[model samples]
Target: MSGTVSDYLLYRLNQWGVRRLYGYPGDGINGILGALGRNSEFQFIQARHEEMAAFMACAHAKFTGEPGVCLATSGPGAIHLLNGLYDAKLDHQPVVAIVGQQKSMGLGGHYQQEVDLPVLFKDVASEYTVMVSHPSAIRHAVDRALRIARAERTVTCIIIPNDVQESPYQRPPQVHGSIHSSVGYSEPRVVPKEQDLRRAAQVLNEGKKVAMLVGAGALNAADEIIEVADLLGAGVAKALLGKAVLPDELPFVTGSIGLLGTKPSWDMMMGCDTLLMVGTSFPYSEFLPPEGLARGVQIDLDGRMLAIRYPMEVPLTGDSQETLRALIPLLKRKEDRSWRDSIEKNVRQWWKVAEGQAMKEANPINPQRVVWELSPKLPDGVILAADSGSAANWFARDLKIRKGMMASLSGNLATMGCGVPYAIGAKFAYPERPVIALVGDGAMQMNGNAELVTVAKYWKEWKDPRFIILVLNNRDLNMVTWEQRVLAGDPKFPASQDLPDFPYARYAESIGLRGIRVDKPEQIARAWDEALSANRPVVLEAYVDPDVPPLPPHITLEQAKHFAEALFKGDEKAAGVVSQSIKAMVEQLKPHKS
Candidate 1:
């Protein structure tokens, strides 16, 4: 009650259950930093870069469903937090960013580190963006920002001037109680109307072959999803964000959809008569069934997103779990299992082809094999974070997410370098669980590698830390290279996609962490074993074969022709790329005896 405004803000944050703050120290934020140091309730987590601090905060919110807090100094530091804050915004995670501004008196004259942060962050933190001018207004601004962020699941910005932060708290008797008394949101159960549920069930019952596409919103409704799938005799395909919504081993559930998906998921979407979309706004409309090919029924909590991706005949607005529960009783059970069985068979066959691809011994090492080997080695309830490029493809196609396991990537933003920071945040949230980061060589060097020192700094503080970063060292932007050949019909340009090969393992070791490099297929398991057993943080760099392409589940004639064009253009790796594509085609076309 007698402390400075900064202390009051920290106390309010503590009341809201925010125990840790991720940020970097700077002159503009010295007052708040001092307050953070004085308070034993909140732990200050320092990062090498302000960007990583925001990334760590976003990841913490993503893993825990709680509003994560981050801070930064004025100017460049505040600007650096934009990318990570956008990641949280697009993903609809709750995060509050506190930025330091130039002293209150230095407003219009253009001080050294002055930047209009409120105007700059307008789009990212559209929910709430306020500059705390008076000390008495701190509680109101903090409470509103925290409430909106939690209730609406958005990014909120609170800017405090350097001088104002150190000012005395002017708490009036009118607003005396702590934030705990007034900081809560509505928790009403959203369920669809009975008539709407009945109508949705009617549409689903009429279709003989129904396919379900689910996303992150359907994660908590896994059991209901399985029940609905069973009742409708449907084959389920998951968007990348919803990869862990259902267990990978589910017989009737195909894996991820779109380019980073299994063959069965593609086939299910193309062959289904009705598409039952649940909680997914998958951006790629082309990957979905043709406009008239299938009737659609969509279920989502946000009605605005309903029928936005594909045309829906029945759009039900409600929570995924409650909506599914209400509709299940009215749904008619389908007796025929032919459609579901065929999709399951394809899923199983795809796994075989995938295994062959993952296990194939190549010149350097198959990138797929790194993820394949790492899959079985992961401890139970492990939290996995994958970068946005080729690493995501491997994680999507090869990594099998069990029920207890958790995994995420930059789903909507698809940004690189989030893997390392995400793993660090996950480790902080769940120290008992093993945390792994699957990053491409380019992404690791881009932003992930720098965060290793942050991990080293905090490694000793954790009770039982098991942080592992698996770098897919292919010495090229492999995903972009494949995109160039397949999507753009261009030959592999020498200086365009190629990246310099760095000693990631040695770098990790130099930072006082364990490091292991694997150039051969046989050494992968050993390297993983060493990394996992190490007491401190570990980096296992695998020299993956850059020639291996991340081929989609289904390849069209246009794509084939594109590859042919690339080969005709005298691309060095064209022949190998063609060979891999042909092999995949043959396996997909192989006859199923059943």
Candidate 2:
């Protein structure tokens, strides 16, 4: 017995456990949508735009760790989905895009909506095929595409001619079930040498004040790292990406390390008698310190990464978890708790200083103040998709993500326009969690607006728990301006960088969503209440002073010098210019200082 390929495809998709699909309906692809509607378990959500459908699909894959589906019609409709699909491809996300093609009659000769979709998508997709006369091959094509998506962790494409979509048939395609999980570090495929482990053990035993620096790789060994840190009475500092994985609230834990890093984390790293580098390969060698005095012991899966920039005293190649597990017993316990307490006290002092001085001023609200205010109102276990610039830095430091909040940005791709789509994906994977897109005005205007339709689909899908868009609207590229003054040494810019200011809140309002503009400092509470109270998509556009800079909780004297040197090239004349900028910054900081 035979059935319509569309029906078989739908049945196969159900078998794969794909419940939600993002796309828009058009004349050429009506049959595919009709087939999808027959099943109550699955949904083909109509998006405002085709590109948004691809974006939503990408986001879904990121959250679910499965291949997300995007459906589209012929020609222009499918063409609009390219950029978002590229994002998924580059990010190594699994997505399957199904596009409608003109009927077989339209082939070879000129016909309306007649573009070759399979050919068009060939480069972007991991695999692609067009089904015209081959009805029997459709099931195999889809199944093959699913396997590729699952294995390669990339996008796949399937083009079905209109006639094939409406072809006569009897039985639906056979469905199959799969139980796939993250390809996380599997069995300790490799282990470290006993000598290397012993050397690290020897150094830690010898050190009086030791601190363990954790990176993303340390996530699996968090418990082990914590155990060893406790044994040595060592303070723990992590990189920004390592935030959630590490024990943040622990007494011995210091904040992150870098320019934005708080606590005396960097100092702790430099001052420690032995610096235990657990699953980290941080690049900034200047900030890393001399490997000789500190005796850096780096434990990593890719042992070559250990001390690639700087030489290491102990380079152990193995699974972070396994190596850490083995080394835990070897470490001798320290009686003194003074070192850990001192770091904790420093963190508290710094926190108080930042909180005090960083409030909105009399004339206007600071961008940092906007972030500070949003910190509390953020939904618990909410998802944050951050862009590269100052917005990410601000969120990285201030947004208290202690117990909840899922961060999509793992490494430093830090491109603009990730927030909306990232949130939508997080929402797709975790239907229960309230997904949030915390975006800055400059960043959002770049790529985020394209994904608004994805959020709209969520609103239509569920009347309650819409994607909340908290936009930090400072009306200028504040992050870039700071980079120019602080890093580039040039505060001057062309007119184009100064973007056109608009009523973003009003535009969101016009789009059938609640758009509340918070111009004054006091309006924040009311705006947040409306955002939290409402069950629909809301855009909180907080107008802030673009000139107000974002400073991390702590900065070392050397980092300050680096900024000065970068701007002025160590010229005495440039000293005046750099000093003036620093003075202005210090004035703003004074209000927050203890």
Candidate 3:
């Protein structure tokens, strides 16, 4: 009970069920690092950068649904954690960020490595931000940060001055005696009243066609969602964040929405007369049914998010499961299957088109084929993390999340460089499960590739060293190049968009892990097999075609015109993209001879 404040803080973290702390050690945090060295309950994961530490923490919380913990030093170190912290905050994941500060005497003197962290972190960790100035206040501050992080599902910051961390415990016994941390926020289920349920049910019953749009908040209520979908005869469309909420193979479920979504999802949303938005705050209003076109009923646990995206006639504020259970009985089962059947037909056709796209062979391997091949090969209960950009497009469209598998990306923040760190965190949380990071060449070089060393360092500690990094080595910022062609009628800017090639496989091998490079399409499966079979961390670098366009399910005339303009302007890759698009359209338009 009597130890340095650093010891007390670590003890409280352990008590709160944080077994691993991801961080980069710095001079300002020497006291805490020394305490960590002496402690066995908590393991310190040394990340190459403070940003990766924070990203790993965010990914841990995303995978485990527990408050993830990270640490960093003063000034630049603390600032480095912001992007990752914002990822946790925007995605509504719980995270506790502990930062070290300069000595107490350097408060406003502009000393080295000194920044006013409390004020700086205010916007990001709006839930709670405290600087522990007193040895006696350590327990209370740590407890409050943890509790608020859990309850609010947001980031919390705890700033500790170096001197305070090393200070001996001089507080009275009563201060420590009063502090008790609960497992989590124990709030009663917020189910809607019968009247609200009846009203929501009435709205759904009145419409001839209803579509259900779900998000991550409905993750635990998949069965209930199915029941509601079955009763209302509604086709379900998932937000990108909710891709894993329901199995992609479900007949009535129309994959993801927005630019990354399937044709069926877009069609269903556009055609529905009534929309039942469950546990989602999907920000793109244009992708959703127009305000006047469809009557909406939104159900969300947080009242603040209700009706934030679309116009809702009925807003049901409660837990997704509890509210759905209450409203299910009140909903009238639509006897007509016409609406659902049409959506199913579209879904079926879309999959065929998608498969064709994934299988198309180019001079260099098509990127989609990589995901398509990886999908069936993935073992059950696998954890997959995707980086933003072209890699994410492949993951969103091609990867299938079976019942037991978990997949995550920087959904709300939509940031890059999270893929490797997220995979590392998932591996740490479930060492027995196979973890894979699907990263683009640009993203890998940006910040993800460095984490390979961290994985190498921790490989020996894992029960199963099945951490695989699938690098789509396309040698260009392919997504941005495609966007320029399709959105701005501009050709690829070689200087800005092109990336110098790096030997990712060799890099992995140099770090004492398995590395396989695939240049031909036929070698992709073999490379994946080798990587998966390896007993340690492995990198499978597939050199994909930079010319293949990541086309959306449906293409607009304007987009086509932009591509044509780019082609006319001497963009060498434009002709190939147009040919690909025309081929896909022809396939889609062709009749099923069956």
| Top candidate by lDDT | 3
Candidate 1 wrongly placed segments (more than 4 Å): 172-181, 590-594
Go through the candidates in order and give each one's C-alpha lDDT.
0.87, 0.69, 0.88
Number of backbone collisions per candidate: 0, 8, 0
Alpha-carbon TM-score of each model against the true structure: 0.96, 0.75, 0.96
What C-alpha lDDT, on a 0 to 100 scale, does residue 468 get in candidate 1? 92
Query: C-alpha displacement of 4 in model 1, angstroms?
Result: 1.0
> Model 1: per-residue lDDT, tens digit, 10-122?
98887778899899989989889989889988888998888898889999988887899999998888999999999998888889999999999989888898999899889
The 10-residue segment with the lowest total lDDT in model 1: 172-181
Lowest lDDT sum, 10 consecutive residues, model 3, at 176-185
What tens digits encode model 2's per-residue C-alpha lDDT throughout 1-594? 345778777877777777888888887787787787776777766666777678778778766667888988988888987766877776666888888888887687779878877678888894555454556656666776777776666788888888888886433345454222212211335677788788889988888888777775665676788789888878887776566556345656676677656645766876777777776666666565566767667787765577785576788888788998888878888888887777666556555554544563633555566666667777766666665566676666666665555564524434566667667667667777776667878867876665664565456655347567777776667677666656655543635456667777787777677788888888877787788777678888888766554554445475476566555544322444444445445643553322
Better of 1 and 2 by TM-score: 1
List model 3 lDDT by residue over 178-281, tens digit each. 55343345656889888988999999999999999999899989999999999888999988888889988788988888888888888998899999999888
What is the alpha-carbon lDDT for the whole of candidate 1?
0.87
